[model samples]
Target chain A: MKDETDIQTPDEALEMAKKSRAAAADAGKKPLVYHLALPAIVGCLIASFALRDGLQLAVTAATMALLALVLWRVRKRGVWVGNLRGAVSYLLASLLIVLTLAAMFAIFWLKRTYGLDWPAAAIGAALFPVMVAMSLVWEKLRHRDLTGKMS
Target chain B: MTNPANGLEPLFNAPTRLQITAFLSGVAEAEFAVLRDMAGVSDSVLSKQLSALSDVGLVELRKSKLDGRQRTWAALTRKGRKSFAAHVAALQQLVQMAARAAE
Candidate 1:
């Protein structure tokens, strides 16, 4: 609407750029619930693996339903990041997936080999904090990237 | 004439537009109200700038119903993202150049 050719000196341009970066970082910030949602889902799924055949299915179904609800609420929040972008983001996400799968497998192994009663629940509990830490790290890295602090 | 070699985009010369694009760059889509608040501009001002950006195919707007009320959302087009990234790179370059010149 205003004049398109509004020019700035180098210093002003730099400052404006910095301000823009700050705005982007702010826009990207999410609530604590967003950070906690996925880990909670994963923790439930891991805990589900320890259940009896019928209960495992039920728990798995419930976990998926919860995931759907979380996604719906996120959409209703009016701002969506969709997925983190860039190679580093992809790498971290992939690492998280691998870690989750490994945890589940470890639970299975412990249950079969040692007939442990607490393997699934214990590992699932451990994963909640680990996943939360990873989530926080991912957010920190994403913020750094958004703010142009990475380079 | 603005020199193309400087890598400063004419479209982003306006600070409001630059700020809007920067915010859009971070999110996939944002509600109109959220963007308005972030930009700290009047609805008319933001609408005008968004319209300008839409005209140039830099951004897209969508309307949807939420809680039985109409809402608008905005996001950068692929072109917009590429352009914004280039503009940021150019700005960084300018800063670097200034530092080198000072040295």
Candidate 2:
């Protein structure tokens, strides 16, 4: 029996990882489903109504679909498999959030600067999904850290 | 240090397991191949260590068939991650204590 502190070779490491995966599979008893999907669908529907418009509808739908895709992929392919890709994807998503905020902030600043009042609906349509998506991703990541689940 | 959950030494307390956990703890999840490469141990040896950690509920394992072959992945449980953090804290303390004694 290998005691604790035993040095492992490359092959051993792979075997250990294999065993770890098997152990996790054996332990997990819950029927896997989209844990956040129903709530997300509901939230998206509410936002669609609030920010109803062609462009708003399109953008919001796309963003929600993208989020759903990510969650689905993460579920199908274990978090370990997409670890590097996931980091990159999250980084890109965060950048999108930053862009959304900057754009909204700019709109408000321009309105104040030029004595123009742009419609909140227009801004809301564009900004709402960005903020929602960002918060959703952040919440997922935080939950993973808190619960050790692969979001 | 002893594990409060099971009255055993923490997984990361063992140098080899510590090194393995240290490597896996940072990344989201690690494949058996990646861990094997990083730990620099034989397959059988690594399997034994992982078994010990799994038995203690500090780590988790999942295996699936990919391309009609088996692929294995490992992740730290919440308890395991917390324990790793605690072990690190303990190690830092030990180091500080040793430094003070040397001084």
Candidate 3:
């Protein structure tokens, strides 16, 4: 409640600074669903590989549609902490993409070589946890950036 | 060798304005109601403070309709972010100075 002109001591200034940091952190906070949605969508996309031909294409299309809808809802929330402007963010994104492709290839190889059943589904199930962890890391890094606390 | 106090901007001396800028610094943009809740300020108070920051080129405001309702969003300009960082650094410096003096 005190204005800057009213802050006469170090304690007052520190309090204001703390409040500012809290405000910044709060601005970046999102609903729990927001965090889980992306990983689930990616999981569906990966799982689609278990289907054949027409069904696979249909699943992929539906997954894309779901991804688009999630993105739209996030945008409508009026806050965007994931701006993807920094080098570290871009690096993380690229790494995820590469890892996803590698996982998909591994699934395909297993399916063709060993006659593994539901290889894509198995890989997708495994990937869900990894993607969730990465999503959490992404949120933490972005929040740090917003608070000017990134090291 | 520069004085940290010199980095502090007069506009952000107001706690409310500093809070607004700090919140905006963390995101691409925020809805007016979200900012109001975070800052714990009324709509009019928030509008006033936002206008002050906007007038000084520290913040940008946009009005749009979402779902058939009017809404306003606020974002910090590049200059605003620079200024806020400086203000925060200055505050930290003050706290450190006090701590050292106490020790």
Candidate 1 lDDT over B37-83, as tens digits, reads 87678898889989988899999999988778898899999999888
DockQ of 2: 0.12
DockQ for every prediction shown: 0.45, 0.12, 0.46
Candidates ranked, most accurate by lDDT first = 1, 3, 2
Residue pairs clashing in model 3 are A4-B13
Please list all clashing residue pairs in model 1, or write none if there are none.
Answer: none
Give a tens-digit lDDT track for model 2, residues B1-103: 5433342244554555865665566556666766676666778877877888888888788886655678777777778877766655544455455567789
Compose the digit string of candidate 2's lDDT tens values, residues A36-137.
443344345434433436865885777688677755555444334223224745785668657656655665575568744443335545554555565556
Model 3, B12-96: lDDT tens digits are 8777787778778777788898888877788888999999999989999999887788889898999998888787778778777
Comparing candidate 1 with candidate 2, which one achieves the higher lDDT? 1
What value does the lDDT take at residue A66 in candidate 3? Answer: 86
Local distance difference test, each candidate: 0.79, 0.55, 0.77
Can you give the lDDT of residue A143 in candidate 1? Answer: 80
- Please give each candidate's TM-score: 0.79, 0.46, 0.76
Task: Highest lDDT: give the candidate number.
Answer: 1
- How far does residue A60 in candidate 1 sit from its true spot (Å)? 3.0
In model 1, which regions exceed 4 Å deviation?
Answer: A1-7, A85-87, A104-119, A148-151, B1-6, B95-103
By TM-score, the best candidate is 1
Cα distance off (Å), candidate 3, residue B68: 2.2
Worst 10 residues of 1 chain A by lDDT: A1-10
The interface RMSD value for candidate 2 stands at 10.6
| Tens-digit per-residue lDDT, A1-151, candidate 3 | 4333455454565465566666666656767786788888888788888888799899889889988888778767777565574688788889899989998889889889997748788788888888888788877777666556521
